[model samples]
Target: MIPSVLPTYNRADLTFVKGEGVWMTEADGRRFLDLGAGIAVNVLGHANPTLVSALTEQAQALWHVSNLYNIPQQQTLADALVAQSFADTVFFTNSGTEACELAVKMARKYWFDKGHPEKVDILGFEGSFHGRSSAGIAAAGGEKLTKGFGPLLPGFSHLTWGDIAAVNDAITDTTAAVIVEPVQGEGGIRPMEDDDLRELRHICEEAGVLLILDEVQCGVGRTGKLFAHEWAGITPDIMMVAKGIGGGFPLGAVLATQDAASGMTAGTHGSTYGGNPLACAVGNAVMNTVATPEFLSDVMRKSGLFRQKLEGLVASHPDVFEEVRGTGLMLGLKCKALNMDVVNAGYDAQVVTVPAADNVVRLLPPLNITDDEITQAVERLEQAAIQVAAQKD
Candidate 1:
């Protein structure tokens, strides 16, 4: 029988009925360890009490109002974000794709308002995923993403990841901005080097081109930092953030410096349900928890343990895993065989993981996962490795 839902996703047969922290209960009453954390969206883990309370309280008081009116909850979230990041202003959106759309528009508008209306070109890196909007597909410029979506929105160019010289050459009078993911999540957990990011910043500054970072997947404390770009000691003129900020709720934000946001005036862009009171309340809860020093430090400590265990797992099963890469809880296991094999084996072991490009099995655990959970996750991976090895033989 045909399912009612669209067939866009190759979904597993298991139905998850409930969740708590890093574990989820399947319909058959099987408890599975969820290491993917809903593709890194469940930052504080599933069914967090703080988030639940915030949502419940906001739902009872207010849900959504037009952007024409003042939403104190939205203002509070914006203020909290600005207080912690380089942005002077924040624009709310419903998802990362909308944030990407706004980032593109704002960058182009910045140059246009500065009397360089011809400067509309944007440069993006290869192997980066920037959601599924038209601008996003063009910004990413991946054949797989742009294949069916033909005659894509133009004015975007691509450069090899980490290629400084290419970036330098790409910057021209027509270039409005350069978009990148500090850590390429869908590109198989490839992280841009600190030095490389700094170099890109220098090049962009000298060439007078804006830097737009797509932090939708790697931001909001996923990489043990408030944002992954914080690791490079540099800041983007415009940044796109989502996923973890909502703590499983559908929310996204575009942050920009005052000067960078100068082009955006009242009614330039807005979202009907974006930054609604309920979303903002949950965002506030997530920010309050993940933005603290103690919480971030715990993430780092847990990251150390996970990395050590992952290294050992790779060493023990050289035939299954080729290497371990990525930072913080956003890790990837580069596989020696088909990445799907490893993912399927993980399912067989009662664990959940995500598959990405470049033959990588992504492991994006919740920031607050316990040490014992980390050990258990590694053990499950070990079992998956054994199963895949047997299948190969």
Candidate 2:
């Protein structure tokens, strides 16, 4: 029997009623330390006060005016994004999936406007997740995402995950762009080497192919930088942003360089509910706090602290944890035991974690997680590991 809610997700039995900072209160009143941060969406943390204030004040003033007319809040957010990023223009959307759709369209339209409609192929990599949309599924080129959905969107090619040579070989005259994630979240937090990313950018430039970066999961201060690509010191011609940008509010945007966006004229693209006052207001608040050097430096310092602790954790429990992978707050523990067993044990130990591919348990705590909270989180993880070890023994 189909339940009222779709059974698409293998949801946990625990029901969270409320959240504050890095903690969530379950229906049974159990306080669980939230290390997943809603899959890196709640950057400032659950029920962040600043985000709440921004949403409430905007709710009282205005909500949705659509893209029919000019929106000040949207303009302000666009300005901020452009100022902080390599983009010269920004287009808002309701989710990362929408942003992915627009990115594909923009890339294709760019070549079309330049009198080269035949150049439509986009090169993607294995273990890359764009979104669940038609364009996204095809770009991912993964059987799991495209099994039932046939007659898939064409003009997308898949390459080896970290092979620069394959990327070089894949880009031909027909190639329109190459899309990638700086650090793969759903693909088990695999971070591309900085040198490789720089080389990818160089290759795209030489081939006259546009580079599109999918930063939806690792942007907005998640990687201890404004974006993970910053570490490589290379910029994408087109970039996708979401998740923490709105501090838990559903919001997303596609940013592009002027040349890349030239084809997207007035009627080329738009959305009804995108860039609404409510979402932008929250997004503004998030940017105000996270874009600061002090905040980002703190995030880096804490990331070092947290990673050091996780290294110790991995050492202490070789029977359960294999190693740690990732950067900044987007860390993951590859499990010697089953990743799901560790995650379930975390539930017993009052800790929350998210699971990804390659048998990894992700720890994406709030950027503002306190030093004390870091200590507590590690202790709780230790407890979970002990429980899993016990079960295994």
Candidate 3:
């Protein structure tokens, strides 16, 4: 039976009726450990008690109120986010893409307010994914995403990551901002060099441009920190955060310094459901639960274990895997064969993974995934690799 809605994603046959912690239960009662974590949005795991209670409580009281009026839960979450990061002001949205759009607009408006509306070109790097919105696609600079989109959104330019000369050359008087993902997610879990990120900061500073980081996928403790750019040891003038922020709820934000956000004082931007009490309530819960010294240390320990285990698996099945790379639990397998083949084979074997631009297999298990679950996932993955390796050329 064909579905009514057009499907944008590759097909996956199995559907789970319910999920808890790191496992999902299928209609047939078969349970599979969910390593994908809904592409890392379920950081705290599905049906997280805290998140459930927060959303349930809020839903019963007030699910939504127009942004036209004050929202206390929104304010509380804003205060928590600002306190945890280098931001002084925050604007809420319903998803990561919305946050990305807002960040780019805010940066350009910043320069526009300074009487440089001519500084409209936004420099983004190749393979970086901000989101699917028109502005995000324009700012990402990936040919695959922009090819069919007619009359590409003007003022967004592309530069190669780590190409100092190329990046510097791309910046001009018309440049309003430079957006980069400290850790590229859909681009195959690539982590940008810290030095290069620092150089980008200096480049933006010298060019008098704002540094806008698209942390939509890699932010909110996905990379074992509140934000991936924290590893780069510098902050962006404007930053976008969404995934993992609401503990699987739809919540996104553009956080900026007071100076960078001044242009957005009032009527500049708005979202009716962006800062709903329900989403903000859960955002507050997620922040309080996940942002902690012990939680981060656990992430470090678990990440080390994953790397060691996956590397061992790769060595054992050298024909199937090339290498395992990425930060923390956001690891990827650079495949020796087609990535989709491995992903499909894993699915057939009751395991799941995500495919990325560089033919990489990504595993974004919950941050609190236990060592036992890790061992099981690796075991299934090894079998899946063996099944793929045995295939004839």
Candidate of highest lDDT: 2
In the order shown, the candidates' Cα RMSDs to the true structure are 0.8, 0.7, 1.3
Instruction: Spell out the clash pairs found in candidate 2.
Output: none
TM-score of 1: 0.99
lDDT of 2 by residue, 201-276 (tens): 9999999999999999999999999999999999999999999998899999999999999999989888999999
Q: How much RMSD separates candidate 2 from the native structure? A: 0.7
Model 3 pairs in collision: none
Residue 314 C-alpha lDDT in model 2: 98
> Model 3 over residues 1-393: C-alpha lDDT tens digits?
667867776677887899899888888888877878888888899898989999999999998778988999999999988999999989999998999889978987888888888988888888888888899898886888888996878888787766756778888878888888888889999998889889888988898889998888888887888788888899999999888888789998999999889788678888989989999999989988889878887888899898999999999988889999999888999999888889988876777788998989999988888998899999989888988998934
lDDT (Cα, tens digit) per residue for candidate 1, span 1-393: 778997889898889999999999999999999999999999999999999999999999998896989999999999999999999999999899999999999999998899999999999989989989899999999998999898999899899888878998888889999999999999999999999999999999999899999999999998889999999999999999999999999999999999999999988898889999999999999999999989988898999999999999999999999999999999999999899999999988999999999999999988999999999999998999999999999
How well does candidate 3 match the true structure, expressed as C-alpha RMSD? 1.3
**What's the distance in Å from true for residue 307, model 3?**
0.6
Q: Candidate 2 — which residues are off by over 4 angstroms?
A: none
